[model samples]
Target: MAISGGRIVIAFVNVIGLALLSCVADGAIQLAGRKHSLHIVRRPRGRNLAGGDPTVFNVMNFGAKTDDKTDNHGPFAQAWNAACQNIGPAKLVIPPGTYMAGQLYFQGPCKGSNPIIVEIQGTIKGTTDISEFQDDGWITFEYLDGLILTGGGTLDGQGAFAWKHNDCRKNINCQHLPKSLKIHRVNNSVIHDIKSVNPLGFHMFVTMSSNITVHHLDISAPADSPNTDGIHVSGSSFVDISHSKIGTGDDCISVGQGSTKVSISNILCGPGHGISVGSLGRTKGEGPVNGVLVKDCTLSQTTNGVRIKTFSKSTPNQASGIVFQDIVMDKVQNPILIDQNYGTSRKKAGKASSQSKVKISDVLYRNIRGSTNTSAAVSLSCSSVFPCERVELVDIDLVYDGTGSTKIVQNPTLSALCMNVKVKPGEHGLIVMEAKVSLGTL
Candidate 1:
């Protein structure tokens, strides 16, 4: 009846394995703890989209109005409203004319038995100060099953002057954020092949949605535009964004709080803050973000390539299982960054309320090959109590243009590291024992 060491180890391993398996099963079904009751692939189109049937509705030559350049709202709104309401398996087509509208909203139950595709050939022209922007939600989709928006046309936000008006000197309380499109609680939606330009605020904001796929979309905003994140996804799960080009004032992709299972690939970002995990915090109580993966992306002239920022004072519910792999950085400020203490003000930081609560852990960066303009290529700073655990770096080759102190700084929290880090001539890569971990080498 003697318990040997080997048996004890085996028993412990088995228990851990079971726990992991259970977690995977739960995540696979529920999807990042959102409890979203939607499935990715729909059934076809017999009565209830029975076995993956394709349903196409065209919005062409079916009651459209004409508008002059001076008039911004005439035919476009008429066509969109009509098609969105009348057609089954809807396709709100914008044919090759300049149709104008103030604001458009895609209301509830916008789905049929088959996958819905909204094809556009013309454009959805927006008005600057029609006063409808204040009232309209600009394409709001709620609780829909599946949506496909494929078009060669554009959705012009006409938001430059509106943005300036809101940013006036006197109107400090003006909350004029002009978003091109907004989607909420939609499951398994696809928005692609479309051009979105000059959004007043975030180009596309996805909230409380799941299993969304955004591909081949081109989003652009002026460099000086404030709060103009290309794609701002919040409280969503299982998002796959790929093969897209985004350039904006703020982060190209800002994964806000309560977002998880985010997989991004083949993205080209420039003239903006690179893809980010957070600026996570602000509200009194909040949820965590986990299971984020970014790979095979390219960044150019971006402030930073990969970043995770949390407030120093605000208590983070949980953040784990984040990874960035196969990234190409071009003139990026800092290719890798992890800041645990994230928030606006450092004076009021949140505290960890309980031990059972989750913390940021298991962040990995691998296969990052690139060059920077004149800055550190890697920087990581985690929480003091629950320091980033299991931080790994494999096959990372980075170089600076000049001798910009290519060195690696080692810290206690940074354990189990394999830095094959190198830099240009006259630069030093070293491990500096500073307030946080700084690992650089040549």
Candidate 2:
């Protein structure tokens, strides 16, 4: 009824070997785990939630009054204050009803400081003129972190009345507009499962933040609506935007200056500027974007699908590690375009700078398939001084509905352009300038 010494020694050795193997597995997990570490929710440990944050916060406690004055922002503010006091992955719950609110300013950084989940069960209608919030700086989240905005509710930026009554309808430089949702210097924030329709200006503008994930969002402004971009990620890093449906007057997703480690996946966009990389030279003396990836996206009936734009007459900047792959386009006006002279109409006054310092390099587009409304499937307008270089295209196919020919407008120094170019009947490849062109079939 007793174990021998030899058996005990063997059991001890076996246990030590198992422990060593577990450590090896942990090492491998750490390498892959770093990418998924910046998630919205912190689970109990060893639970997988890839689509969204697994830690759910219920916002059903926040009551809504239907007959409440729409102009009074007090009830929601009080509720928000109470929710903020009850911290630790808490949700500012808005139950189903018409919740009338005004300019609600959230004063944070909060307790435990984990992301505060604001789940909208019903509509949170803004009361005052959205233009006034833009002018007066009403709703602004400054220097905060761990914030989540979820639920299938809309943040109505009631600017229709303001826009109709404004006197600067005919003026080009009307006024400095504000965005519906503005987050500045907030880190590790996630905005998911939300619909922001008809914002006053740009729907969401992320001025300075990092590790932001925007997923499963539906952003829309009218086709005739002006200055309403779906999502504008500026001056941020490590951003992942996926599962989004955007239709706006402006770009669906516009990556502005000082953004890096950006990935866009599984997006459907239309009636917009499509997915853009720049409009990158305006910054006086900052480095260009680095490590940008766009994959598994669709652009249907859009102005332009994939574009990398810079100014021809601006201070020299540089863009690197930009890639657009696995894209599908349908009835897009300009399926693919790269414009060096990316100035607004205001540039007609004069060149912003004497020479263009913006250097475009390592830009690659691959596996793009779809039909375009326009003939120019691919257009490159790189700067003369610092042109686009190291460009590659693999498995590029454009079927133009047998309607017209696809034209290729080249730049001065397209340093490298490689592709397997083909189109339907009556379609031909047109190159305005000389570049290294490789033609073959996939």
Candidate 3:
């Protein structure tokens, strides 16, 4: 897998090769990974799966230690309390090799029936001695309703022994380095064929869960590893991430602030930071982000593509029905963004407050085509005090192959940067960019 100009390049990865027999999205199965076969999520009407004859429970029969340094978190919590006291369908196997674990929680309301599986074929090494990570997740799965985490194993968060103590992005009172799978408040769950590597932060972190169903994953990290985000959804609600192959450094899927109906599709992001919903009103009872749907993704060399960040000290509706359709932006650097003055400080985002209170509304960017290095290919720096309502831009085809020294060939400056949102910002106005079909570049 190597494409130079159009950039793909990922030789191999597929840890166990992802396999989810259920959770119907109508049906389509080609499941390969690393270099892509994608097309998962479909065929499910069977609620909370893991049906009949399960009863496995074998973490080397509760004395787990694959010689990888012997610290299998108390034999994987005594094999998940004997498969959560096995009542019906149960299976908590973690066979194969290399195990060094430190914080393996897995608490549940489980007494069996309605799935209680946790396969993990092998290699779960995360104890580089970060003081045994007293929680912030290193494989935690709380109050599970009906979990069915898959196998294709590999959750190695050694993160080069904690990426030089990852100073929480410039030391904002740091000290939070665990994260290598933490699905809190787990409800009807289904995490498929996994393979997350190098994490000390954000690599599959769904919060306050609802009907969760993360798919065929293969998340990695290395691009100077800063934030390591690859599938992070906060406050969750009916979440469903799909056939993933994320390369992280940050935000290869980040929907923050009380997320709702989140559903990202067949993604294959790159040297990260793309696919976001919010920087979000910088913290203040911040909630309310409704229905988000990012579609068939492919963002190579990413920096920002398909984004919506808010933080002029936000939180009102903050965001609403957001959709980014059939995307494919290689050489990306800001393919399409909407930062309602995100983290200030460009002289505080050019003296911010174009009235910004956050509050965004029905947003959409359809069939977004690729190639942009940065000539500002679409940015709606919003916030004339809560602006951004029904925004639309259909079939946007981008192109501006920047080679660096501001290099651009043939009539460059492919622009789109509106301030007062090109419409109105608050008062819940009819703010829309309203582009139908053809709009510049390419």
Candidate 4:
């Protein structure tokens, strides 16, 4: 079920919010016209496990002190080793306390027969000092399957001081600071009920993984923190993210190239860049993105709301079957956008200045309503080289909040911009233009 060819049609007029249920059960999501279930990932049962009740391996037992100064890296590693190697089914617990941890790596492919649970009840604080991270990330859960990471605790990256060195916004060659949490090459995992706050870079990076469901997460950082994306998913598939409150400096949730069948719903995003699908197609041989559904989300005070951005002068690729529906914008800047001219200006693009090569197609924005702070609430600045095809905006009702700028346009509500994209007759709403798309007011 690689949802390619841009034929996926999933929509609902009214949506019901569903809580994250147990890991083994199929969580059926109720929608107005469709019922799509989040099939939680689970591997087959066999065993190196010691057939018994699950054992609890506490970090304190492995010489982890509950102080705020001593680095608990060794103790945490030892506990993960004991739990992954010694048990049929084990619970790795870090009890309630303030802990200073530097580069906590929970690498997996455990010998256990059953699922492994890493329950963190205390706060694990990261260093403001940049020399501590030898790897590219702080806390990494790599090469694991059937993991449950919960416990409502915080992975605090204490990034207020470290953000000064994060010059990726100004310097393109800046070495990125470590992300707070990285889930890489993992499968069949449920990460929920956690709070990840103030990372040096992205709060969570889910990359090269599949069959994962992430929900009930509260991720936040300063709105001005540079490059601090809340959750970034790249090169992954069959993922579901819902019921999260995310506010950060960068994208609250970003789906990059090679990602497919990603379902995002019930999110609260503000004080950051809104949920995005790109800034991609930079390098040659880059993969295409397809089968994305973003619905039932709310964006407030964000830079851009529900956008698909491809880099300028990009390589050849295609992005299709992307849907954004039932979204609410609360004083957002750009409530609906499709920018095919994104770039970092450290270096100039040379292929052609007029257009990009990435072909974007089959996008749907339906039932989106709210107020935007910007006068032009919608902008579809597609590429002139490849252009955009089969884009639709239906039932959109957005108005200017009258507080973004002092200089007001005569008709703010109908001030959407479109170029190099086509909306078929009887398949569009609001603004209508053949060559340059402008719409009627909501």
Candidate 5:
């Protein structure tokens, strides 16, 4: 007998009520007299939970073991298929236990109007061996819209062994290490209350996606771990990353080329390179970066804070309309850096004849107060050929504290350095630096 849609809703509510009561009374009900497993609450037949109830597809029912030894990739795939095929809202639940998994990819335009939710309650540990996964990441959720990935669980990359092979700095032909999590082409999604630890590469990589928000995430790796950027966004736009704690070796949040309209606020970054706008012009014909805002963020003991870097001798590129305001730094090496000759050889950059093709304009730094370990608080090493234009600094109070030491210190002074850059007064009608060029109100 086919149950009507209305009856299905009532049944679901009743079941949920009973389940809650049982949970309140004695924690969890045993399923089929199983010693350590909870009962699986099945939904009614022939009726979907589109707007009424959500079908729960527990991964354990599909032969996933909680011992953290067996590979649970097959069970996860099985559960995902069932959830994606459902005619309504569905949730794939990972219960409270440590589970070992190889790379798992969830790709979907689900069969329902509502979004699919992944409620992870247990730790998902990835394999240490790099050859286990085919892609450059452990878990990838792609081509899914209106998705929510939440729960107070951990994604453990166990990257201590893999970090030894990362030689990308010395060798240009290095193999890229696997990131912890990759979200590609997924729109209108939110990821919260998650922790990614010890990734061999970037902790979270978002590319070719839009309208996404990531909040309340704790991402960490060792300070010496190479290339472990906390969150890296490339070729994506309309993203918001807030209220997060990120500590790693590389940039806390790196906004790469072709990305625009990104907002990063209230971020706690430490023991890493601070937030950056670009290493743009690395390749020819790359797009520009615009409309980026980094405000209300704190950086402690970072190598650099609030940086904008571009390579020299690259194809023509432009970076404009960027702002970094109300940021606090502590014992940072370089509090504010705008290096247009980044990654260029010293011989090539110092030739006195080479000119950078990347144009930097309309950048403002306001209310940036902090203490720096080195004397040079602000280093504006702009290109000699195409100098930075319309640069403004207002209410910047950076002082040398004489507290710590770094390798990059070269007779530090409590002053700013401007090389081949033009200055302009900001909206407040003030220029803070004493450079050789004349400053004019914008």
Candidate 6:
């Protein structure tokens, strides 16, 4: 009877364990089903059930081929036309597969009470033949307000062949290559969850737009590819770029002239020139770039980190109310740079002049700590004639890490070069006196 009781207890315990396991399995299945349902529900609806109408136009229904070789420009245009004409909120869907396309433009003040959504779930492969594109972008959306461009797909710019033909660096008259994506004069828009790779020129260009938000993007290209800026913003205001990873050859984020009230945060930049405010003042009669903020950024293995560059002999301009704070740099070349003589003429004058026409003032660099690969961790080559004023640096701690044989040893002990600028104590009253190295010999 004792052996029978023990056997009965063991059987009971096994049954309980099996029941627990079954319950766990059932819970997992239910969770997975809920997740799937959420995804389906989040997807753009084909029919407006509440309004009793169908407004979603799938590109495949208009004859877009999924085989990846056929050009889908015609079908895409057809679908765009139908969706743009829809009276209510409409969606243009590109289903999952590779679709080769040429230069396509979507121009709108789309006929809708609500914003139009372009949902891409597949790859849009750009044609390698550069002649097929007449403008500077492979795909462009122009004059569109209240647009929503969200996708989990890729925009592949086959730029390797065209990169060889690019001669913009050597010749000033070089033809401009096409950008992967360009949004011109578009306002109140959102671009999220997209991957842009290997563009012939810039990965994405935003110009003449306002109130734009770009987030959750993965932009990349080979480090050696020239002129492939991850994101270039010009003549735009009230723009925000956050939570993006950008690695490319040129500036990860280039804020051009006439850009104001811009905010950049939570960005990861590497294998490129880090976030740059200007290359401003290169042209005459340019407007002021003001009220820009770059914070909480990580730049690793980049050429420069947190830079503000302006031209010397250009028209008078002002770059003011700029802030760079809470940045982490890992082995960057120039961790902090404020060059007022950015693109000086190659013809050297008999006398050295530090006069820059650009008025760079009210710039702040705070809580910047990093290891710089160069000895001069902080370089401020401001203009002598129109000197930079009210430039403040607080809690900046950068170390030189170049100790190998191949490293250039010119001024290896130099920590900072402040030419002609006014340094003020920050809000925390933290300033580095030793970093104020006067380079009078330059």
Measured over all alpha carbons after superposition, the RMSD of each candidate to the real structure, in angstroms, is 12.2, 18.1, 20.3, 9.8, 20.8, 19.9
Report the number of the highest-TM-score candidate.
4
lDDT of 2 by residue, 146-240 (tens): 77777788777765655454433356336635577777887777778887877667788877787777899888877767767788877888788
**TM-score of model 1 vs. true structure:** 0.72
Candidates ranked, most accurate by TM-score first: 4, 5, 6, 2, 1, 3
Q: Candidate 3's residue-wise lDDT over 1-442, tens digit each? A: 2323212212112112212111111111111111212223343344557477887989897788788888888878988988888888888989889898788888978787767889999889887788767778888889878888888999988787678768777864477677899899888788898899888888878888888888889999896787889888998788888888999898889999888888899899988988899777766786888888889889987888889887765555567778788899887888888887765666766553434587776676777887787667776666665556546555566666666525565665555544543222322432222233332444
Selected candidate, larger lDDT, 4 vs 5: 4
lDDT of 2: 0.62
Which pairs clash inside model 4? 49-88, 50-88, 430-440, 431-439, 431-440
Give per-residue CA lDDT, model 6, range 1-442, as digits (tens).
Answer: 0122111111111011111100111001000100100001112222222333438999999999989799999999999999988988788999889999999988897888677888888999999877798889899998787778887989999888888788876774477688999999988788999999988899999999988889999999988888899999999888889999999988999998998888899999998999999888766778789888898999988999999988666688888888888899887888888877665554531124535678887777767876666665677666666767666665565655554425755544534545566444333643323222121111
Score each candidate by Cα lDDT: 0.61, 0.62, 0.73, 0.77, 0.75, 0.75
* Model 5 residue pairs with clashes: 375-413
Pairs in clash, predicted candidate 6: 354-384, 355-385
How does candidate 5 score on lDDT?
0.75
The better candidate by TM-score, 4 or 6, is: 4
State candidate 4's TM-score: 0.83
**Residue 191 deviation, candidate 6, in Å?**
0.7
Error of 1 at 133 (Å): 2.7
Q: Quick one: best lDDT, which candidate?
A: 4
Worst 10 residues of 5 by lDDT: 21-30
CA error at residue 421 for candidate 6, angstroms: 0.9
Residue range with the least summed lDDT across 10 consecutive positions in model 4: 21-30
TM-score of each: 0.72, 0.73, 0.34, 0.83, 0.82, 0.81
